[model samples]
Target chain A: MEKWRATSNLRRSLKSILNRQLSSVSEFRYLNEKRSCQSSFNLIRDCKSLGQVNAIQHRCFSSASTLVQRNPSFSTLNSDDISYFKGLLGEKSVIQDEDRLETVNTDWMHKYKGSSKLLLLPRSTEEVAQILRYCNSRCLAVVPQGGNTGLVGGSVPVFDEVIVNVSSMKNIISFDKVSGILVCEAGCILENLISFLDNQGFIMPLDLGAKGSCQIGGNVSTNAGGLRLVRYGSLHENVLGLEAVLANGDVLDMLGTLRKDNTGYDLKHLFIGSEGSLGIVTKVSILTPPKLSSVNIAFLACNDYSSCQKLLMEAKRKLGEILSAFEFLDTEAMNLVLHQFDGVRNPLPASMHNFYILIETTGSDESYNRYLY
Target chain B: MEKWRATSNLRRSLKSILNRQLSSVSEFRYLNEKRSCQSSFNLIRDCKSLGQVNAIQHRCFSSASTLVQRNPSFSTLNSDDISYFKGLLGEKSVIQDEDRLETVNTDWMHKYKGSSKLLLLPRSTEEVAQILRYCNSRCLAVVPQGGNTGLVGGSVPVFDEVIVNVSSMKNIISFDKVSGILVCEAGCILENLISFLDNQGFIMPLDLGAKGSCQIGGNVSTNAGGLRLVRYGSLHENVLGLEAVLANGDVLDMLGTLRKDNTGYDLKHLFIGSEGSLGIVTKVSILTPPKLSSVNIAFLACNDYSSCQKLLMEAKRKLGEILSAFEFLDTEAMNLVLHQFDGVRNPLPASMHNFYILIETTGSDESYNRYLY
Candidate 1:
């Protein structure tokens, strides 16, 4: 009975939160306001249980000034419940106060700087699921945030959505070194994952320049493409499985590391690049590559774009499967590189060409050198 | 008038092919006797005058016989068209015989074997477009065949569809060695493209086992994923732009090598893995990578999965950014390899561990020895 009473109180607060959020959506604002007003009629009918109902109402509408003068059954909050929740989760981890809220509100792109609101830092998936279930029942919008380095405006919230930052929920759940698969929290940074894999004599199959700040969750959301796509591929190939919380607060436990499993509709692919419009990814399983025996790199200079094309054809024939990276550089991009990097000069002479390319090839077979010779 | 008569005669032969193929389908077997009676009516209608009205009737009957009969409209193809597209770049390339038809019918999987009464090999994009326009107007179901290495039943015809094999369309249209971009014909073999680039000290950005047999068009159609995807990525990343013929026989000129273009919705992505359902990709513009100086390969045996994970973490932490392929091999797969390949021996001792990993790394910087140490 105590748990039921507490849940009912939570539901009332949640409904109020939903009403506030819906009131801002232009079309539904007036409808929700009318619905809130009509709740007084229901309160009048429940007057026999008025004492319990009034206590719940008081916890929600703490200030009389925020409420309208309505039916005799309607009651107002005295002033303690709001303060109690404002202090919840403060002991478990650092909660974002007004000062820290400013930075978390905006994404890397200044395009979407959401109005800073409550930042709930969850330490475990269960806590997140619980919070989501509570928020969901009350019609609250929950936004999951990570390293927040997305080019697309997906990591940031749009309205009065509750921000559930999973940065605190960091843990390496399991890793099968034989299969080269790692299961970790979504908040895990790509740099940390790479570093961890490197120690195991393996490396994350894919890489990018934003590796230092980009979280794996954000990477999975945008299906982020990077430099190593010339070799290791995009996130679509690297990510084996995921665990996500859907919009309705249903947990999707799709954690599988098998290479080939055609059980049914591939639900994982649908959520991968969904940008959180579909669900919030809590955990991830990724396939990593083992360390290589030997590697080689080369910077090639070409007379023209046609020369680069000719070079690729010849190199693939000679290099066979050993060809790894074949990155191209236009004259403008090469010039930019030369100017930006200290002591870095163009490999080609000024009279020679209009474009440049950086090529690297690696192989476990020694015969790769014989072809190079 | 002669061309129109030739089309009318072709339509008669096509109707017979459709009827024959329909009999082979298990679902349509019930409709077999009913379809046979209509063939005689098709023969008389197919022999009508070379007028536009008769051509329309010819198409209606042709589509009615095949599965998913999509009737071609008059606006798609005019009866007065008389244009001949010869060779590409002065190379006379055309083959129209039973022997050649049999050769291009079967793909690598041998699942999608085509039985085209007449096969037309077009040498260039212009020729292909012209052929499609002419056939499309007569309501002909045309199947576009490349190296025929497709896994799905995409490159082959299910019925009496005109088979347009782009085998003779092999030609290097443009090559920019500096930019590492190559524009080539659809029928160009992957191996030949690699060889052409290799001779000039460059290489194909991607590689696979069936390099010699697979065509660039086949690669683009299926969005091919291969071993090199552990590094270079799929055809979707490498291919910058494509030229294709839409279902309505309209040529979509989308050949450009720009990396970043936010002009509109990405239309090229739709055609990449559509398996030639939407359009026929005629020309391709791809970004190629530069050649590497050298490569290093290493094989490792891990005692346990956790130690393997630790080893990868250590290597990545110690190696910094210069790391590449780290392929994990289970003992089951390793034993299979040894059993399958005659005289093949395990790189590591059998008593040491349950799994082996092959690692390779490549870099252009001259100080490669320091990374190894």
Candidate 2:
């Protein structure tokens, strides 16, 4: 019963961490204000129970007020800037409410936090250009944010830099069935794009754990590599072209659909993986590969790393072109997954091996792949 | 006999253009001097036969002296620079022989030519750093050449910039079979690496017509995209890490083997497609995919573009993961290929279709794939 209670408390703490409830932030702020003289580290040290300590630590780390100071080079937000943003994007798009600003100010990992007074939600490339232009002229540094699912502290601001969210600009411009070329607004969520492509009998060149929240713009900006990269490759190869707005608000359109165009210096590559320092990517044109018919997955136990290595080599030689994914995990990782998820049982005996390998093969010939297995 | 004479004349002209024999440059120079007053346009008009016109046109275009003048900012090469290069890299490594310099001075396309007085071959990264450090101090511009197979005149010098060839630095540093990561010197030829990976039961993520001559460094610099990109993706996705020597001689070692490292900004990407403008890439660590066993190819005829589009959709839906390549060609392309290559016959009846589609599928199971087909 005591262990159950501890697990329940831990679940609640994890839930709070994952889902940013509006009440939790205010409750945390009120509790922090009441004990203004005591530091969060001291409070963590004083906690009697492990569950209570975990919850408190989670809350303390997530709030922006308890985080480090903002960079001084950037100017603080003023009423004029807020008014200008409202005039441009409307009052609803100009977010200033403290309750809603908490999530935007914090990152997915709760590692980086910013104290921005305003967030401008742009609905179009033109709007993004105008906002960036104003910010550049006013010496107001701005952070271009998408789904805020970046592992690095790239999506959040380091100082009083204005946050320009592109989520409202989600739109699918066009798709050529023959070429498997997709042109869409950058703010479109990756999962939505995947679903859309699935319906069209195609698949995106990349897939990741954060697909549900990560936007296509963020993926291109960071040059994200994911699970399917071992098979489909990276965005640089899949993305044929893109349209970006430079820092000075000049729109650079290199959005070409042709596969083999060697006209001039490939300037589109400069914007890719630049992380928004050079410009804000507003639209993307990407090539999607056709989905195959058969998929075979095998979960195997490996006695040692050498055996895993040998198995991978054998799989490569025998499987040839059908091998899609080859992923491995150590015993410690397996144990952690098993412990965290109640439904996930280990496939092999607990003491049988130290490594687990998961191999996936996809091809047009279902029977051939099955026979090989 | 007359047809044979015409063909032989055309071949000689083509050879002069493609081969870049030591005498071709001097012959082209002499021809240009003889026709100093006659414009190439006029010469083409004045020709008596098509074969004569072709040869004259080839000569007119291939002569570097007849082209635009070099950039004036770069200083002219002196005896001191040649001596310094010879001292750094032994006498054999420093090439000043006119006959040997012809191929190095001319590009693969034979479109651009450089009047470089000296070529320095560096065998190691340390030697590259030392050469660049001296060049920077002397205010002498430098061009880093690898395979000299670039299409954008990147590998060749624009003027008197010293050529630092890295072909001597072709060394396979290491390969981790477990992770399928191969590390090698930048100067390693792409085809050679492919063969090495083939022996290990793996395949490089990229393939191109220039693979036989293009170095891995050049491929990374140009971000070369080729035929297999539809299946394997691009270099940006496959390259995990690299080592680069900056303009000021700073050796930036970012060669990491781990799949995931999000500690800071991905600075290595800045060099992936920078075309050697940012720095000289000395080494690369890339992820190679495992080779599959079963392979199937089908040549289908399409009545129209719409039918080809529908067929592609169907192929993607049915093939799923095993679909490796889906290529299309028009009747004109088919006819050209058929006319150019002997023993190349059309897959379909001549009167049947306007378009041809080639689909290739690879998987682990041979019988399953064959049964599906």
Candidate 3:
């Protein structure tokens, strides 16, 4: 226990020292803006300090700036950066309203609060890339915001960083009916994408409860795993290719639709679930799934957990790959669901078992039903 | 275009020089056992040669390897290192059968060739960790191999390094029937797991075409995607917890059945699809599903790509989430399956359209099937 405590302390201390050193460097760069370009690269080059170096060596680590950067508190960006952004966006996109900023700073969870002085809303990937390039050159930190529906404080500023809101960039660039691939802007809402695909008779392979407000960009950032994970899968599987602007503003155009591309290391994955710490994803290309005609949902009450297991095995054997959902509603979860939701009823009596599985099976016709019956 | 060409040429030159330096260092390490404890981590630290330095710089410049580890050839370990590994294993389960090694090296596509000088098969996760610690201290690169049915060359050694074959480590540790979480060794075959679950009346939520030969470790290391990914999802989604040994021999024990864990960076994913460059996974905890009773399979021929896509969308609207498999088979893939496999008939006429779809609808009994059909 003593050794473990020491190890934890050492790790934290090292992290603090590294953050201090980084913040000092950032401050130095900000003060001497002329050398900011050269200094930013140096900081990236020395990132090993943040990841590897032990903290026990440095005693005065409390003053170190965290990896998350902040703009001067209570101060907005200079007219130069704002005008530069406005010049690229041609005016209507950037949001400077404090009320809107407050809303954007606090996400759906209401957990994280940001201090970003200004928020730039870009309408296109090119504009986004340009903005990032400008920010990188000036050694400015950026917070990439999507639908503002994130849970883990991602998509919101951790510090007083500039928020590059991609909400205005929502547009379905292209759709390949054959491959079921959808190419769209990063800010495209999940709900909109699903509806559009539904209208066209296709469906995005993945869905979640947050689909109503969550942006595809935010989803990709957290590699969002929701209920359909039992069926359609997570964002990592659905997202095919991404167009992201790196920290250095280099546009990584990994927009290929080929399922098998082993040209090099998969860079896109690093940004996925990175929470915009590494880069700003501007556009996304994802593999959508074909739609189904119907579904059959059964809320089953099992005698025991073993019975539930048996039930799944039987379904798999009889159903093959058609079983879409096999959700276990623990007794506690079931009680909570009943307590929280209106019009939702428990299918099984409380005294039956400790677990109740909500089994939902989907298919086109009566063949599946025959086996179940 | 000129700038791009120039950059590409510089990259190519840098790559060749780095490759040569690594090759020579590996050769030197092989000749002298004392130098065998080298890892990719050391390559970044002790690189004084221009070639080695340039390679490291190239990695830094790319923003590619910065997110992930650069690919390391398997020639870092020596024969003495293998002996040391044997000492760590206590000599009981190690296997060096050339025929077995040769078969295991070749993947499903026959693309990877394993040429390891030694093959150590550990029977338990503890043994695996011990061997890794010993090897890591000696700077030895250990290639982790299982039922090597990978589409990519992730399971095979890149050079003449020691191979830690996990075949002997197969065993079921524990299972929670209530939570539907199962813990097993990395070497457990997917089919065996399915069978075990079947006997118990539950099913592994995930399934793949390579279930017969592919081990869970291989599936995890490759983040394997399969047919059921359209439903139960890829290995990454189904995977709940893992026991992995890092490069430096530290064991990260994240074995649990918690649906929600916000502890820290999801370390499991870092090793998943890392191709054994980062660590070797020894055990896995996964969420299985309760069995379902039935499914409906449909083989449909569409007029065109758009029509096929439209058909899927219509089905999803009609079926909701019950549509499990909407496999879009390219004409080429369909023809290949039909020609190569017996009992696999073409669902559509070859000359009629550009593509064919095998859509399966899964659900409960006949009553539900009637509604779907």
Candidate 4:
């Protein structure tokens, strides 16, 4: 609980800082056009320090509304609806407390916030279906949330929509070792799935910075492409099938373990990247690759972008399939990372070049990969 | 023309024979229940020989209607529409010749055949847009076709929908050698693009058996997954952007060259595997990987299925990154391949095993990969 409070406070502070910075930049642009260069210089010299800017910026925008207006098409939460939800989900599953609701209403970036009065935690697909059906009938808008770690502001609501959180629905249905197919509930955390696959001598095809908080269902829903996409491809190719509940509470089950099935229109692809607009993804069936034995990482510096590009081509030509990742960062980006994070040193000399490239190779022959490098 | 005729004849004969075999099996099932065991044996004995089966089967199903019924909602070809098409695209572009229309109406597998009277070949994206806009206003159903190599009957029209073929639009717009981003018209043949990339020291991320005939548009539209998918991944990840024409003839240009863009909802994904339903893909921007220097293919035999599964896990463990392809075939499949093609002998001794696995590894160092194998 204490950790959660700290995280919440950090997120709010970051959001406030960013909001203030954006407003200040816009005001500066407006003022610069009316004032002369000398006057602008004087204004900058007279302004308060960086710490004071936050307070002043906050005061300037506090009188104006920042919250998104609730959609009139959606019904506001009432006592009867809350009672019905509690009766169906039990009082413990229904969250109405203001403090608890704050976390569910805000996104990870703390950029988008909603005033949703109710947050329902359904433990099963059937319960999700029931909730959606009732919400549909009552003309209530709903935001189907997984871990709510989405960067695109997709997981949160724009208004006071009912939040149907699926964190309690985490479950690993089944796994076929021979086929490397994993069937799991939508709310299963990515890192947990990765750990489970690791035990089975396999690995999830995707790796992301938010793996700890992101859920498999949300990954599939958003068609999240990450670090391993260059090697394992996107979710559309790795996901064998999935089960989703439509707007009217109709369950569209296209889940199958077959690697190749050309039955019909492949309706599953529609819901894969729909981001919960078309349906609420209940479960996912994915293909995990076998875990490799040998892995190596190398960091190199390049004098220019062209040299980096040439190096990538050379790596592809020489390394072929063993080259797992070839990520590059500009000098400015590297400096920012070094400045922001403590105890993180550059693999290459800081004065070496303007760009740094990180290459990872995984193969059965560690000696061969090392020799090639 | 001669090769085309021979290929067309072979495809039709194969389809006819398969259709007859299906009907015969159904009839045999019904007759076996009513007839005595001896009679059933005698009937089998009295049937035509293996060589004669093809001829007999062809005659059995030839008279049946093999064409799909035309959709009532789509208007049939009229003189005015043909005249307008000919006026916009020259008369030579409007293919009304019976011999040519036969190939356009039929799919590669000869499984589906449409009865459209005209086929319009557009040479440019603007031409395609104009044709679709005219067709939309006229309420004429249009089937946007590429190489017509799709097995799912997606490239071919189901009924008399006007076939607006894009084979004439094959053009490589531009390719940035540094970025490895290739911008080309949708009609470019897969093999042509492969050859072009090979010259630039790059390779298409996807490969298929129909590389010689399949077009980039068809491959992207169907989201074709082939052998190289185990290494390079599907089109969704490789296709950076695309230009499509909507049902209303609105040109939706999302052809971006950036590797990372989080501007808005990625609308290009909707058209990636849509099978040309939502829109007609006119152009594509794809990221091509650099060609590798070393490649090795090995064939190994395993005594049992368990051994084969274990070998796969071991390969993944041992050859962590260099493992490009791991394919297995049973003895029956091997025998069939051997029997179907002359001079194609099994890599391993025939007496060795019942299951064969093909392993391909690629890396920068040929010696290292060879030593590891």
Best by DockQ: 2
Displacement of residue B251 (Cα, Å) in model 1 is 6.1
Report the C-alpha lDDT of model 4 over B1-373, residue by residue, as the tens digit: 3433332333233233223222322232232233322121112211211112223346465622332223233456688999999999999999999999899889888965767788999998788888877876776777778999987566665556678888998999999987789999999999999999999988898888999989998888788887776566567668888887654455667788866443323556656765675567899999888776678999999989999998987776666566778888998999899999999998776585789999987665676768777
DockQ, model 1, C-alpha based = 0.03
Each prediction's TM-score versus the true structure: 0.52, 0.74, 0.66, 0.77
DockQ of each: 0.03, 0.18, 0.11, 0.15
Interface RMSD of each: 19.1, 23.7, 15.2, 18.9
In candidate 1, stretches whose alpha carbon ends up further than 4 angstroms from where it belongs are A1-103, A108-112, A116-144, A150-154, A158-173, A205-213, A223-373, B1-113, B118-142, B149-154, B205-213, B223-237, B240-274, B291-373
Residue by residue across A37-64, what tens digits does model 2's lDDT show? 1122111111111222233457555543
**What is the per-residue lDDT of model 4 for residues A1-373, given as tens digits with 9 covering 90 to 100?**
3433332333233233223222322233232333322121112211211112333346555521232223334456789899999989999999989998999888888865767788999988888888877876776777888999987567766567788888898899999987789999999999999999999989999999999999999998888888886567678778988887655565666677877553323446646765675568999999898887678989999898889988987776677666778888998899899999999998775565789999987665666668778
lDDT of 1 by residue, B1-373 (tens): 3433332333232233323322222122122233332122121112111122223346556532233322222122222321232332222343346787676666567644555555667767777777776665555556777887766455665445566778787898999765578999888999999999887666686677878888898788777766655455556557777887654455666677765322222345545754564467899998776666556778899867777776666555444234446677878888899899999998776584776877666544334423454
Candidate 2 chain B: worst-modelled 10 consecutive residues by lDDT: B40-49
In angstroms, how far off is A338's CA in candidate 1? 16
Candidate 4 segments whose C-alpha is farther than 4 A from its true place: A1-67, A151-153, A157-159, A266-274, A347-353, B1-68, B109-113, B150-161, B258-274, B302-306
Residue B128 accuracy (lDDT) in model 3: 79
In angstroms, the error of model 4 at B100 is: 2.4
Task: Rank candidates, TM-score, best first.
Answer: 4, 2, 3, 1
| Candidate 3, superposed: residue stretches over 4 Å from native | A1-76, A97-115, A150-159, A203-214, A223-233, A254-269, A287-373, B1-37, B40-83, B95-115, B149-159, B205-212, B225-230, B254-267, B295-363, B366-373
Instruction: State which candidate, 1 or 3, has the greater TM-score.
Output: 3
Name the TM-score of candidate 4. 0.77
The candidate, 2 or 4, that scores higher on lDDT is 4
